[model samples]
Target: MYESFFGLAREPFSVAPDPRFLYLSKQHRDALGYLNYGLRRAGGFVLLTGEIGAGKTTVWRAFLEQLPPRLDVAYVVNPKMSVQALLKRLCESLQVELPADADRPGAEADLIDALHGHLLLAHAQGRRTLVVVDEAQALALPVLEQLRLLTNLVTNEDKLVQVLLIGQPELRQLLEHPEMAPVAQRIVARFHLQTLSRDETEAYLVHRLTVAGLTGPLPFEDEAIRRIHRLCRGTPRRINVLCDRAMTLAAERGQLRVDRALVDQAASQVFDLPGLRRVGPGQAARWVAGGAAAVLAVFALTRLLPPWQTAGATVAAASTPSTASAPSSPSAPVSAVPASALAATAVPPSPSAGKHVASAASPASPPPVTASAAPLPHGLQPYDSQAEAGDTLASQVFGQHLPESEAWTRLARRWNPAFTPTADPCAELPRQGLRCHSSQGGLGPVRLLDRPGWLLLTGPDGRSTRVLLEGLQGDQARLSLANGRTLTVPLLKIAPWWQGEFHTLWRSPPAYAGDGVLAADGASGTWLAQQLARLDGGPAQDGAEGLALRIRAFQMAQGLRPDGLPGPLTLMRLNHATGVSEPTLAGSAAAR
Candidate 1:
């Protein structure tokens, strides 16, 4: 349904095991290598294992597509079968003639002799034979031993038959059983496939999109992709289900792009996230964000505290009346009472989570994190060179130190060089059909948004400095000063000074009139009805109650609060998702 709308030749995230859309991540590539090695080595048993929905079958199919010449193959998928049935199936797969009474009892000798005769003939012709068992973990002991016996159908120099066993992780553990010692001795090659990493997950998504005829920019926003990883945990099948649902929902809402809120909404509906799906989308986003921030703050603060400080603070706080109250002693540890923790109980701090984490993790005597004073000599480690290089690149290239405000000017020019800013850049930009968005998060949020923004840095002495973030390359960031000097610094190097604030520009939808609640009246209401029709597939609903219900449904699916009145965040997401021609870090509009 969404293929034409999203400009996709076909659905990109189908869960089917199609080798055509196979993405070879590092571990997946390694898994295929092991399979090929086993084929060449002609081992008695080759083992491949991974979690369910880990794309094992895809890799297996990809490997099976290319087989060497003179190789006869028999494949079995269903594992729940008797040893006699399995043997008969194998003979049938190999095209060996079976007796009319092959199904009769006590015909085991006939089946084995027939298989051996065929194998001997194939071996005489310098051919090899392979038996592949899918879901081999369920194979009974006798059935497994029989396969081992088949491997015994051998010549002096070469084994005539090879068996490959593929299943979930249990198959690997099954081989370690004391009872399966003979089978263990014959495993010449083995590999366990693992889930993709965050980087690999991004690559996997893009690769699949590119293969699905997506030549435009990615349909998934960076944050949406990040959320997909968190929800799916790198499982290929889970990613497929989540992405497909999100796109369909976006398409129905006339959205061309998928964002974090859309992903959360899709996950709430499709996946089994308790409490998330039952509530309004906005509340669920808050719930998830709240929980993550609380956990992150506690963990970050605990890491920054010394053991003695942590223990003292805990004891003192317990001795005090309430966690909300201040300590009696002036010398009490600052951590003795957590003011934010109590406030967070009533209101979640999801938007400011990065700020909280940065503050909590900051040391009391926050050390200076500025780069080296002078350039390092040659032959030092790469990090040292990079650290010193950032300063050098900043100094000699951009010799003048411009205040942070100048970063905004540099950022603005990137979108339009001839554009002149009014008194209030943020306010003025909106009038020009552009917008200024400020967010508090680590480099991750910036990278996800895929925009060049200015970051506010708090110096060791508690001074605020601003630097222009021009671009990012892998782990290195390209930061600029006032006069266009740019330096490449590892992202980690600058993490110490950055306080989670990022300022960037985005294009606004036509006649946006700024951020506010959009009601069920006037031009906004007419527009809302038009947009909702795509999803609701019904006549326009203009009455407050009727329109409110449709609006609420859209909000819930987008993971908004479902206030039944759309606002800036809600409308901006609609613009991005529905193809309003905004600039992105990914370059082009796959959504359009």
Candidate 2:
């Protein structure tokens, strides 16, 4: 219905086992290789299995088109029958005529005799007989055992007939049974087809569209493709269903492009889910900013507690009754009074006590504590050298499959929003409930943070590279690149680019409560300017002029208006820029 409306010659998404429409993805190619190997070997069974609608039959049909002339083929589409009925179906597939008047026992014996004779005759004629059973998972144990016994017609060199079993994943389970050991042992080649990757899914759609006679650009947008891949899990059958419905919906609406909304509407109808809509960029920023604020508030509260407590204590002491005001010593601890008596006797300090309060109170003496000097999270080991830290960090991201080794994979899995490989790692960091703090301080400051991070390195050729700083040993630093390369460099041997610009990924707190005061005069402004300086990978500046210049530079870099005033969005970006981990949207979580 959508073909003509979309200016196509044919329907691109017909859910049939059409060999011409087969998209040979990596898994499909591998499966075809396995099937070809079985045919060449010709002495044993070849097993092919996949999830339902994963294109097992389509792959087999593609295989059938390339069959050699020397191979005599018999295709069985249905295998859900008793042994006698199965044998009859097999005979019928081979075009062998059965005896109409024969008894049940006689007919069974005759069928086997004829099949064995027919295979031997084909072998004598320099041809191979191959039987392909579709949905073999439905075949009973007795029927399967009988098929296994048929392989006994083998000659001294090779079997006269080969068998190929194709079914859903259940076929693997059936073959794993102890009773099916003989059948399993004879299988020379096996492959389980998997769904396509996102890239492959996109290509598959285009290929189908081209085959259906589209000469123009693809109708689906990139975001639409992404959503389709996510909702369909890269299953071609489901993708076909969704795309077909989406195309029809688009046609009805007179829309030329198959946009994200129509794709979502089609998916909702097909999958029986609610309609999905893209979150506005502003809304997403708010969520990320909210999370970041929570993180800052947590650390800020911890940092400011001493000052707040000291001030509170000073006020409390000033209000305490003097030795002359009551029959109790002013130095007595509050705990000295019985709980019941204290609760009943507690009263507000009188205005007269205010006269002596200032002279007697000195509780607000301790200095404020900053979180910058706080220790790293537990279990995060610090390195003495930048190179050592980078190597250890690299091993975690690009290393082999080791426990607690695949750092990126672990973070990606834990992140609220599902991340695709194509996503910008830096841009998605905030949505992951984490932030990336970039600093231009030397290895001393980076190491002082005592957290794993990605360090920006500039080569002698002026090419920028990123290395993971995992840990350190003595004076040597462990650094690793995305390509699985590692280096152990002494602190003194660090590169010029190692001028200390690095980004760290870390967790956010459970909640955030704050005044959101980022750009203020005095100390807070200085702190904010320092953070912006670090995020800019530039020298720390002093006074308002330097702060404004740095803020404008950062705004320009982030593609924001260079107003020099840090607004909510600017503050959000600043927080993310100084955050410990990459942030990604919780779109997947919201969808759920």
Candidate 3:
């Protein structure tokens, strides 16, 4: 209903894990890194653990996206089956057939043989096989042991079959049990996925909007984003739920934008805030106190006092009492006040004052004046959430400063002068390397990515650095450095950037204006110019430089070499970026 009012193509905030709406936060990156590490390691286990609704499944999907073609993957999403059933499922996922009506023992033997054969085949093909069990906590102890035994299928130098166990926090406890010691010890990488931060939450909202084809300011106010982060506590799933509800509410109310009020309303209805009742004891007390005060004031004015009085003397005291007054019959009407005046008096001051007093008098009281009623703990903003955690783990991973955007821009400029200022320059440094940006764009949408066990660090060059997958936490991930340091990344930053083959067709030369700018053709260029004109500052001296930057960004975004040159792939990206029709290029000529 409100789409037209909001100028939206679709609801910007939906809880569904639409791969199109995934936002990879820092925690997600770490989770992906863990998955990657587990898959790459030789014949060892990897564990990923996270809280409920932390986007473990989404992270798993993202990891699948980045899988090398040679790696054979078996994903087990359900873990409630018996050991034999679990084995059968795994085999089925791997396309290994079992004999019909095979008994449990027979099935196990056949499954093992098939697995062994597949592993050998994979080895011959220079590939590795990985078995990922999601919701591993649901697996029985015997089933877990059976899984461990599968790891026994190995070459003399390394185990051929890799296992990944992903589950909630209970899985961690399960692995630590005495009976599961062997399995726990076999884990080579582990990571725990965490929630997004406040800033990340904002980016997450915008990201969803952009992915949904929005090309303007997001529909949510900053305060609304903050409330969402607080209410969701950085959990991707919770954020999605709350945001979806908020959008629905906004649409229902025929509002064009989502604000703090809408988010608070949505969060209150969705997430069960145990101690956050809408009209709790504090509110009740205030209402009661105000009512009592009003009553007391009325009693003092109407019942006890005369219409006029001197300093300590009543009006009647100044005049002698007239015996003729017949003792001023007590039952007689003594005074008359206009009913309008009384009604006016009955209305109390705005509730705002009472709320302020309550908040100031008691620090524990929720601040009513806050943008939203949701409470966000420290260290939970989107950008800070991941970057801070990465920084914590950086010393252990790279032991140095990460590179900055300026460095990457300088490098791109030097490598390809045509890489004009318009290109979005990015660099992937070695282990502990950082990608620098001249001007960092605001946070994008929140989505999940498949990057396993990825960490962000600063290189010795004073830039950022990243440590990919060293630890696992259930099907989610926890970041860790080689030195045993651990950190959590948000889910938004870990989500994969949206791009495909057509991504390159949208590529355009850099335009020196602002981030996310693209110009594929005359129409797109006109649109870009129009959008630039609407900006507070006019377009840069060379809009081409900005276009170049976007192209660079497109290159990095598309997993290209980040050379800042507009090849066929670059052109495709430009087409995608500008939402223009892709132009056909002959053979490899356009690519060059």
Top-scoring candidate (lDDT): 1
Which of the predicted structures, 2 or 3, would earn the higher lDDT when compared with the native?
2
The C-alpha TM-scores of every prediction are: 0.53, 0.48, 0.52
Estimate the lDDT of model 3.
0.54
Q: Residue 156, candidate 1: how far off, in angstroms?
A: 2.0
lDDT of 1 by residue, 1-592 (tens): 8989978898799998998888766476557656765775674899989899898888888777655557898999987898899989999999999977899988888999999999999988878899999988898888898899998877788888899999999998888899899998999888888887776787788778867887556778766877889889999999999999999999999988899889989999899997355666775576566545544555665678885365344334344353233324322333333433322233223323423433554354332222232222221222333444345432333344556446666677667676675555665566666677787755445654566778776555565557777666544566665556455565656766677788887765454566556556777677777766654454564777667756655544343455777666566555654566544443433221
Model 1 score (lDDT)? 0.69
Clash number for every model? 8, 33, 125
Q: CA lDDT of 360 in candidate 3?
A: 45
Alpha carbon deviation, residue 534, candidate 3 (Å):
46
Worst 10 residues of 3 by lDDT: 497-506
lDDT of each: 0.69, 0.64, 0.54
Deviation in Å, model 2, residue 29 alpha carbon: 1.4
Which stretches in model 3 have alpha-carbon errors above 4 Å? 1-5, 104-106, 274-592
